[model samples]
Target: MYGHRKNISDVRTPDRFSYPPSPSPSSYSTSSGKSTSGRSRVRGAARSVAGVFVACFTPPEEDTHHHSSSVYGGVSDTFSSTSDFSGASDSTDGRKRGTARGIYGTRNDSTHMKEPGSVKFTIAEIHYATKNFALALKVGQGGFGTVYKGQLQDGTLVAVKRAKKIMYDNSIGGEFQSEIQALSKVEHLNLVKCYGYLQHGEERIIVVEYVPNGTLREHLDCIKGDVLSFASRLDIAIDVAHAITYLHTYTDHPIIHRDIKSSNILLTEKLRAKVADFGFARLAADVESGQTHVSTQVKGTAGYLDPEYLRTYQLTEKSDVYSFGILLVELVTGRRPIEAKRELKERVTARWAMKKFTDGFAISVLDPKLEKSEANGLAIEKILELALQCVHSHRRNRPIMRRCAEVLWNIRKDYKELLD
Candidate 1:
């Protein structure tokens, strides 16, 4: 039932004003609201710099009884006088209303206003939610810091990411504020929701939605649950595409997700994906100002970083497109971007997989954990073809995130039709 045409331009892009439709059984939904007329002004600007994807957190146990030694007293007197988390109301209505200033800003600074839905959490409330950062409640840990499963007095569950002391003292601390600004501006179904943050003395913590299931990396490795079916993987790829699309097209400013690896992709109990971790995220250079790409020190994981960015230090949304290409290869091959155990030629999975794909052996690179079906075989070929374009050395050769999502939508539609 599907056409053999694999040309990127052959598949029509979804309306610029709207998002791609949600796939069947996926909780992620697209908003039908049309974007304003100016949306397409920078449509071609998508060729700009790359960014990393969000970070992932582990799931915690249900029990909340454990309580570690209180770290409250040391910084209590300092921030308590500034933050309003000690308020009596547990509901949003009772939360204090004040300007959302930077961690170092003064209390009465009217220069910075809080974004809607943004909250300023107290150290006491943070300590209570995380049970004093108890080891038993720890969910995930990464370069950013340790994540804990926490419950508020109102019984709302959240993932509390506490920056390590060293990270707080390093460049990552700046990323902390950068992430807060980035997270505050965007909201989408496939993106993880940010609840609030805590900045007490040496403690720098971010509280976000608690996604119970582990990360996409955990699932791909089969660490958290069963092997992901081809359909599930396809769905996740689309979900992430939607998230990136939102960041690039829908936000007031185009945001580049510099990191787009599997570990940065979090999964839910239903296997729907949410793009997390904004430490490496950045706003695209203002297209309105006629600037095309932002020039900055290169940052990102080794295997997933865009080559052009590394060589030239210029970044564009297409940089993320390159990383997404690497992620697609990882999903299909079930191998890390770099596999030291493999032969020299095969050491870089993306290169090896692309070689196989171009040599007319695309199906040969399919993840061994997946069973090969007629539909599955065809899907692999189409996906790799897309990945090929995405990973092209030249940024202009890559498809925009919007185009990527559209291609994936067609792939899923065709695959499901073939299965039926």
Candidate 2:
């Protein structure tokens, strides 16, 4: 039982959630170097960051400050490149699909207004649900703010996210708007659902579905729950693939999940994976706009960021593909992208594993905790092969999310057959 606020240390990784701050005030000013008013500057910055971020619960740190942004330029819709994803698509049994807001002196007017259909929770109701933000109700914390577990009058369990006040002065306000915009537009079995939101004077709170199980990062760290078997890991991978696929292709305008790491992946009691946090999410370029990628500021975690995105500041769906590739390596090797404690050659887990894979020792990269078998070894090779394609240096070479999902389906089918 999580009786105390800090008791859920096992549920999240504190050191993994350090998001880099958004661009400085200079980035928000006009080309002439004229200083913009506070209102204009905030609005300009918010438009720049059309994404969301929901870091896992870490106890609030007084000295810690963080910012979120969609610093890149124009949005484009270019999900065109698709490599043949021919793989074993054997039919499998169907699985069940499962499915925020701020406070204020009540400033209901934001350039990024919440779309209709998203319930608006009054500040008073939020206070009652959260027991006035009592320490006991706290579930998670991060650079954005603190999260508390609450139950609504209708008996719906929700996770209420409260942004740090200082964050309002920076990009948190934009992050909040971007998250609402992204979450409000999409619904998928593998994505987290938004319940409502409350925005009081200085307080910004987003209410979301409560995921009982801890994050995938916690599970990989062996700090929470049961060992994740190869089969379970595969299922979770497919679930995530589905979520990303929905975001990239099914949405009215393609959405790019700027950040995709283990810490942002929350699991349900049934061990189903739900892609959480859209603070770093933004709309992709419009296909009809004759654009290719969203030229946004460099945003995303360190190891998982695409090399091309960093170099050119051009973002595409393949950016997510690159991160997913890293995620695949993480799942297979059960190692962080960067293991600071590792030796010189082994420090970067992805590169180290890729070397082992290319040298005809792919199985060597397998997590020692996993059982070694012909099926498992073969699955690892197949997965890393797909991962290799994902982490390709060029975005064009990386497979689309839909293609990745297809390949994973085949891999899962083959893995199941090998076991039989």
Candidate 3:
């Protein structure tokens, strides 16, 4: 499980130590000067052997413990009080000899180096990457916290959401953890990808993949003269509907995106819709009775909220459907979910549009920018019918996500055929 690969070039040992030629026998002289060369030769051989033994047995000055064994005899054991040869090896062979110092550095070899990829970004690095929480790079702000745009050294862009403590209450901390858990598991073309997270000190930052096209709300508000085409609007609606379907029924536990509005829906360069902001999402229980819906202060945009769910606080997948119904109205009518300036009865556009559809005045609610071409008008009617079904007052009456997806897909198919 734990191992490392070392470079062969970095590991090298000294070549074999050649001993000087033994001194000639004639070079040594004793008491007898006459032809004692034979005796001198014998003495000279003894001296050479003694020199080799001394060099091998001598311990380094730093060594404090001693134990030795001869490699040649395999039986010779010499113990010295000041030296420890516990890990030393003989290198008489012609092949390379590797020293512990050259391989790993320390004689005791207690410390191990961390692998190359083992060092992840530290808290400080993430802080620096985000410009120490600069205000200018902030992309969005919400109840949870502010999200800032950051770039890594490798030129990859990321959105870092720093969770702000709501009213100094730690209870909201659970929301941050929940968002992390939910986003890490969910992956789809319409869902945003969570890159990673940084929990440092009192701040918790969630890193996510950055999409360039900004929020659907911004695009709708900024682009004035040239409105989104009918086909583009339908395409966006279908994409967002599919995203909600994945969260509600595709996953192991159904997720309720409590907050689904124009601001929460992000767009890619191609205008593909991606669902963002899961701060209010919750997982439904597997067992029927195990599910418990929160009936506290309602949390959603005013006009887009499901009136029944809002009053009762009985949150469910249907609540998201109701919001999507309002979004569809936005796409078709080119209006906000709640237009305060409109007549008091027309406060919630979804409700108003539904009434208009029943009164056979649905065409009046369609955006004027949409051309009156035969194909466009027919497509608009089909989409209006689907949107009306989505905003049904009874949660049970609303179609399931799968059914919604099928309806939208069929609408797209029919519209595309008409254009052809």
Clash pairs of candidate 3? 65-83, 65-84, 66-83
Error (Å) of candidate 1 at residue 197 is 0.6
Q: What TM-score goes with each of the models?
A: 0.73, 0.74, 0.67
Q: Write the per-residue lDDT of candidate 2 for residues 369-414, one digit (tens) a residue.
A: 8987777877776676677667665565566777778778877887
Instruction: Tell me the tens digit of each residue's lDDT in model 3 across 1-420.
Output: 001111123211122122224333123222112124433332222222212212222333332222211101011122122111111112111111122222112111111112211123557767776888788887766555677888765566777777665422443465566567677556667876666676666767777767777767666765522467888888899888878877776665667776677777778888888787665566643334443443333444445666555444455677788778778878888787767799965655655654454343556677776676656655555565556556655555555665666767777777778788
Per-residue accuracy of model 1 over 1-420 as CA lDDT, tens digit each: 121222222222121222122121121111222122211211222121111111101111221111111111111000000111111211111111124322211121111124522888999998899889898998766656778899887777888888878655446566778678888876666777777888878988887777888888888889989999999999999989888877777677778877777877889899988888776678876665456677666566657767666655566888888889889989989998778798866767876776565444667788988876778777886777677667655565567777778878878887888889
Point to the candidate with the largest lDDT.
2
Full-model lDDT, candidate 1: 0.64
Which of the two candidates, 1 or 2, achieves a greater lDDT against the reference?
2
TM-score of 2: 0.74
Tell me how far the alpha carbon of residue 201 in candidate 2 is from the true structure, in angstroms, after superposition: 0.9
lDDT of residue 401 for candidate 3:
60
